[model samples]
Target: MSAQLPKIFITGATGLVGSALVTELLAKGHHLRALVRTSSAQLPGSVEQVVGELGQPVDLSDSQVVIHAAARVHVMQETTSDPLVEFRAVNVDATLALARQAIAAGVRRFVYISSIKVNGEGTEQGKPFKTNDVPAPADPYGISKMEAEQGLMALAKESDMEVVIIRPVLVYGPGVKANFRSMMNWLNKGIPLPLGRIDNKRSLVALDNLVDLIVTCAQHPAAANQTFLVSDGEDLSTTELLTRMSKALDRPARLLPVPAGLLELSGKLLGKDAVMQRLCGSLQVDISHTRDTLGWVPPVSVDSALRKTADHFLSTL
Candidate 1:
């Protein structure tokens, strides 16, 4: 360990990624300052909390690195009015505002947690997305993230700070919600799901793996001014994922051969085509650049991570 650990400031410390990152950084002996809204709860022992909204200016004094992980992540309904405005307030405006503060405070590194949607929705013919590909953000959330990255890169060019952007795909683990929890619920009930026939590769990152990469980027010299796409490096089809979940839970896999198109249509009628798209869409990420450049590999394998997820779910039952 370095004699003097870097003073790190993080946003979204209560969020899935931010909380995990806080744990990882604490283990590495880094000094942390976390920003939180007035309504946010205090984190575990001794973390310095500076109460402020994401839209407000951050005080980055004594901070050497800033990890901007806060964002509005929910996919809004099609009828959502001014979705972009809401997303921009946190994702773009606040992110840049914090970055500017970090630069002024003499922070050397800024790590931004972006999303894979910046690359695009789905891959071409099962081919994974690379880091250098042009950004094709589909939704307001994705567009906001993309614009934030551009703004951060421009800020880096003008300031002394080194900016490293990471795009993580489908992160899941303990305390996960929405689709991940729903999947676990289906498995727990031993329900026969009609997802056995759909063969689509979905790339995912374990919470630990994503945190490890972020910590590495925070310190690694090669990570400066680079954009990287990260994942577990093992793509799994929906059936394969369900099968593994079953094995992890020590339950029999119950799968039916329902037509993929029919399922998609049903989801559409229910205004849940996005959910179906996530389960059945092919969204692979090529992380060779991160590995080759930073010599970083995901510390946990897909099987082990999946098993951990299952174990967590089982323990909760």
Candidate 2:
């Protein structure tokens, strides 16, 4: 941090990651211009809001850095007829469009917040995903993100604007929703869960950790044109995660030692195959490059992050 911070233009300011990044940057006295869909979008008082949509023309007059955090995230039950096309429209097409605008506006750096899905869904034990792994995007959302990363890298080669891609695994923290919240509810209710015997490891990134990496790339010269995977650097199994969450909530973990095969079968019978696979799958990432490159490490431990999440969840009750 310097006496004068660079002006940053960021998208998805109201999102989980974006909002956290904004708060962090603002606290550091950085000027931020956020692209929002509406002028009335809720944001901090000092954040300059530019009412606009992605893939559309935007003014980047004096911005020195652009952080692309907005995308059409994966949906559990896709309602669209053509999901890939829809994902491409926002994640790929719009992302490159904005990068081109940043180039034209002479922005110095572009940091893309990508997903680990760019490296495929799950991994085997003792084999984690690295930055150099061949792209094996599984679904429409992952495909779109991979395409966007390619487009950005290509554009970076042709311009002076530096590009840094960060792929983060499951990110959890205060205000988290979906499965994490559901699991918390289940634990809080002292319901028995049949996930005790599952032996799988999954890496997760706390909001503080991911935001720290993003900010590091914003100005770090070594981050230029490099892709990094980030996590808590500690992997956990489904049972471990539930047990830890229960500890945070001060509830006894009522876990039944169900067989993994039986759980998968039950999932298939209930049309929750994907859910079960996620719960029992191992998806780990190697952040050694991130550490060796920028000398960065996760600032928050898993337990600390879980406690923060639990505290927030309890406060809402």
Which one is best on lDDT? 2
Please give, for residues 1-317, the per-residue lDDT of candidate 2 as tens digits: 54568899999889889989999999888899999998744699899999898999999989999999999999988999999999999999999999999999999999999999999999997899999999999999999999999999999999999999999999999989888999999999999999899899999999999999999999898999999999999999999999999999999999999999999899999999889889988999999999999999899999999999999999999
What's the lDDT for candidate 1?
Answer: 0.88
CA deviation > 4 Å runs, candidate 2: 1-3
> lDDT values of the candidates?
0.88, 0.94
Each model's total of backbone clashes: 0, 0
Per-residue alpha-carbon lDDT of candidate 1 for residues 217-250, written as tens digits (9 for 90 to 100) = 9989999999999999889888899999888878
Tell me the TM-score of each prediction against the true structure.
0.95, 0.98
**RMSD over all Cα atoms, model 2:** 1.1
Cα deviation of 241 in candidate 2 (Å)? 0.4
